[model samples]
Target: MDYGIMFQEENESMKERFDLSMERIGQIISEETVPQPFRDYFVRTASFIRMMGEYLRFIESGDQKKASIEVLKEWNRKLYEDILPGHKAALGGYEKSYADPAYAAARLGEGYGRLFSYLYKEIRGDIVFVHENRMKDITILNETFIEIYNMFEDEIPEVSTVKEVLYWFVSDYTDHTVSYRVREGLDPSLSFAVDIIKNYDLNDLKYLYYFGEYISDSELKTASFLNSLPEETVRLMANTYTEGYCRGFEVMGRDLKKKGMVQIRYELGFERMVKYAIENFEALGLKIILCRAAVWTVNTNAGRKAGYYSTSPNRQYEYDHRYDEAIYLNKAFKDRKAAVLKVAYEEYKELAAAYAGPAVMETFGKEGFKPVNKPEANRLDLKQEKLAVEMSNESSRILKQYVPGDETSFTIIAFPVPEIGEDFEKIFEETIAINTLDYEKYKGIQQSIIDALDEASHVEIRGKGENRTRLTVALHPIGNRDRETNFENCVADVNIPLGEVFTSPRLTGTQGTLSVSTVYIGEFQFKNLIMTFENGMIKDYGCDNFENPEEGKALVKQMILKNHDTLPMGEFAIGTNTTAYAMAQRFGILDKLPILIVEKMGPHFAVGDTCYSWAEDSPVYNPDGKEIIARDNEVSVLRKEDVSKAYFSCHTDITIPYAELDSIETIRPDGSRVSIIEDGKFVLKGTEELNLPLSGV
Candidate 1:
């Protein structure tokens, strides 16, 4: 399908108006009216924007489709060849760069900033119009487009005096552009982006390339397949998706009505379902923000990115270059980002106020990611890591200062990708079934286990065979049964196809060796993973996948452990979703599953930030209406006094499947043993139904 024709029959007509923005800016830069230094900057900026525009127009025309390998090369080039020049200039504090003090002051002081601002706004407006209101001729989106376009329609702003305009550009755009940095920092929920896939016409492949984002066959193919699914099936998929989002708000006890919107972040191909989710959210009176991930630095986060996006054309390439920040690190770069974000948020305060948060539709089931580590690629050295952490913390604090942490909520759900293996479709169908599992059945069984756990002072979890996991997680005793419960009875909401009773374990005596035969953490592969915990924090870790010892250590350091010297074992729990495990084994896609889904497949361990990071004070309860008292470990408790020591800003799960386990036992206060899984199978009496999937074996 000509995706544009799906919504935009007049994409050609849009050409003239759209090209004019860049053309007019080019005209201004070419004009002799602008001063030499100011003119030089716009000359470079204008050329870059126009090059991007031309490239976008080419992709939009749906001609000269490049092969995946070719696209991947360009993708590599853009991140390396094309964009790095500008990033380096800006980071090095060069006067010629846009972030230069003299240039910013001049650009903002002169009317040039606002004109360029207006020009940039026009391009942004076009992108937004294409996304939000895709109707006849883009008539609705172009209404604002017409108003903004007419600025150049009247007296063209002078090129010579553009400094002052640039300041307002930064000032006006700050609030809207950077609001999520806070949302991410504070709550970090998946609801931050759910509608991207729910409402759009993913079948309209033209929409794929319109955002000026680089795209490859992988992304287009993914979206096309999803669009091919029956509309009803897609709706069921979306309903399962958005329902998890709403349930998050309901479970959190936050007032969803106060919030007016939900940000939908997703990959390509899921637009058919995205549209349905938008309607579902709208039915609840929440508007949807369908923002794509950042292509420009003003909104980029190097590796840890959010917003609607496409698949990484190459994960190895991405892994190699994740720490691109080292190219331009200093107090100056931080200040520039901070100034820009602050300004952007100020501009969008009203919209930010209306945001409920993100509802993410995540996908998994791709082959296990075994990223080849590249040492030459820029990485945050020890000093840079500290600075990066500090910058993140400060920026987060800046965001929360505007958007309160107490106000929003979110949810995340992952599905399988077609690239998982030979039985991709079969696994995908099974995953859907898992996502829509019987809530009441699991809830009842989970409560029975929680009831048992409430009586225990601590849970002793040990592994067998190649698995060396031995951790004693102390449980917070439930003081009152009538008002509170020990573990939250996880169902098919928020975390779908769920079967785990998890909490922030008391860290005082939570120590021992935790190991998994193999696990995928953060899209990077791990094998024969071992971690030793001392008072909950990860004291030591090792993996045997890479050849050299130091290389393996660095791999774990950068990916799994998030560069922290040590991370607290943030979460420890049993896996109640034996059906998920059975399905994985049956389909032979165990290694391909995402942690979001894999964690549900077995007993897992999380290293870094606890599940209750920002909202420990907000009381949570199990299905039996009992308050879950185990929301904090000793590390999180520091938040009540010192904020610096409170968070490690990461939580990655390493799951041990039932097949790898010796046992998962619950220890009663009197030291009695209650086995949940023994010899790689469910042995708990009430949990026998979970073992039904493994019947033949």
Candidate 2:
């Protein structure tokens, strides 16, 4: 029913209000009453906002669709020009706008400068929202900034007064932000992505400029490459993606018919694949919910991008602003956010009920990012850290209350980007082959390892060749040997290009050190990463990624431990995809592989929540008719008594390469041992087939 037009018409009054707010912003920019430094700040910020407003008007004008390729490229460049790699330094004013809290506090007085800095940062991040025609958000945010600017007329306001003004501003708008976010996650009518996918002529490269993401060479090249592929190849890629998602439901024994929608989380430039995927998903009666990644500090989680995104122009910018919420985070703010979230979920409870889960397509092969630890970065203090963890747990509980995790299923797949190097096409095709590997072959090999593991009380893994990893992972006791198994014979469902049999280890006796010479997690690269565990919980962790020991430790704490005192070893698995590992080694792109694929390259351990976090109670079985029973660890089992204590809501996998691994042995209760891998080669009775790939046979 032309919902986009309908929505625009319904919000005609909002557009008028937005116009008035932009005019007000312009007036503030020229006001002479404010002091020099303060006036400068306001002028620069408001000018940026005005530019965004103009962009918004252009988008709303419907001229973007008719614009020529050059015009669209220009618009796209203008939208992200401030944060582009080469131009970022020129935009330092935006960084300095909020950067030095101490300098800001000194310049604009203790309370006022900090608040203004945060407000400026918030406004800066909302440029994309403006471009996307999220008029209400931009309008309300602009009005708040103007309201604050208006307070500086005759005299500088009291510190307490400024704090109260900002606090109330956030509190008042909490419902608006939270409710719209929740609604967008479930409502298919908010069809920015669907319209772009179904309506736009995707073959035209100009269509890539429509989404408000930074258009980089990587994205442009990726889209061009996919465009060059045959329609059958594109269809096959989409079929693999959607079929894996469907298999997730079937394998888990969940009813896909019960769910009406699935969220598509992906990188930009893969819209061609996404377009095909949308059609395939529709055939399964699932509508697409293409939500943008978190742009606002309130919605962002520890610098991770959640939804559709482009290659980050500046990783440091993201790193510096990861904890921007620390400026206003307190018990009161936390409670207010939770309350608003509850109300929002309740408002959209019906839509949330039919929500299946996220189907994630991740991209890799970018240069390893080593973030410079900026001193000006906002960091959560001890109290805020505790509160952050609590809020995450509470938020998870609230979300599960509406979209019960047991009923939902998700799938994740990864492909290389053009940045993988000169052999991008070759690597891409090899990746496709790796993803479409003989699942039945892996099933047989992994089951042999799983059967060996199930008979053991604990497995011993020791690293060879300077890797320094030695660990003992306890297995859950099998209740019925004939009908129950500890590990699931993982294939390509849920986690694509897969070859692993994993289980939540019994944490009571799981102990030792896990070390990797080099590994990439999210965007950060770690060198000489070493994590020591005592009774399955991380005891001491260190990495030589930074010159300063303390700085390196802080990085580890933020990224891996996620500010927790300790995280339990939630999962343990042996990655049997020697073919993927061989492909990576052949291309010298092992360091660039995403965890989604790299986790299947060797034995890896995940810290935080287990694979089955909120869905621990859901019964799952392998193809062999044995129910997988090792779904919960000591920590996850606490869900029944207190869910807040049960899950950490973060799972980070750290893998050790096969070249560095010594041996993996199953230690039976009868004091006998069966070696699955010896000296980095599969030596088990039925798993010799896996060694062929590593041997280059």
RMSD of each: 10.0, 2.2
Per-structure clash totals for the candidates: 53, 0
C-alpha RMSD (angstroms) for model 1: 10.0
Candidate 2: TM-score? 0.96
Q: What TM-score do all the candidates reach, one by one?
A: 0.75, 0.96
lDDT of 1 by residue, 1-697 (tens): 2233433445455556655555665565456554554455456555555554544444445442443445534533442232232443234322333322234335544334324333332333233333332222223223333333334435454553233333344344444435544433223122323322433345556555544344655566667777777888888988988888878778778788898777777776666667788789889987666656653333555446677766664455455446544544556656666776676567667766777777887787666666565433445778877777667766666566566656777777777666765676677677788888888898888777777777777777767777777778877777776676656777776677678878777777788888887787756668888888887877888888778777778778777776778888778766688778888787777777777778877777788777777777888766667788877888888988988788877788888887777776788778897877778777777877877877754
- What tens-digit string does per-residue lDDT give for candidate 2 at 1-697? 4545645653576878887888888888777988877787778778888888777767768887778989987776665665545445455533454444444555666556656667776787666675556667788788888877788776777867776776777777888777777887888887876787788887798877777777888888999999999999888889999999999999999999999999999998889999999999999999889888877668888757787888886676577668867777899999999999999999889899999999999999999887777554567899999899888888888999999888999999988899999999999999888889997888988888888898999999999978889999999999898999999899989999979989899998999999998888888889999999888999999999999988888889988888898999989999999999999999999889988888897899999999888888889999999999999988898888987889897999999889889999999999899999998899999988888888872
lDDT of 2 at 356: 93
lDDT of each: 0.63, 0.84
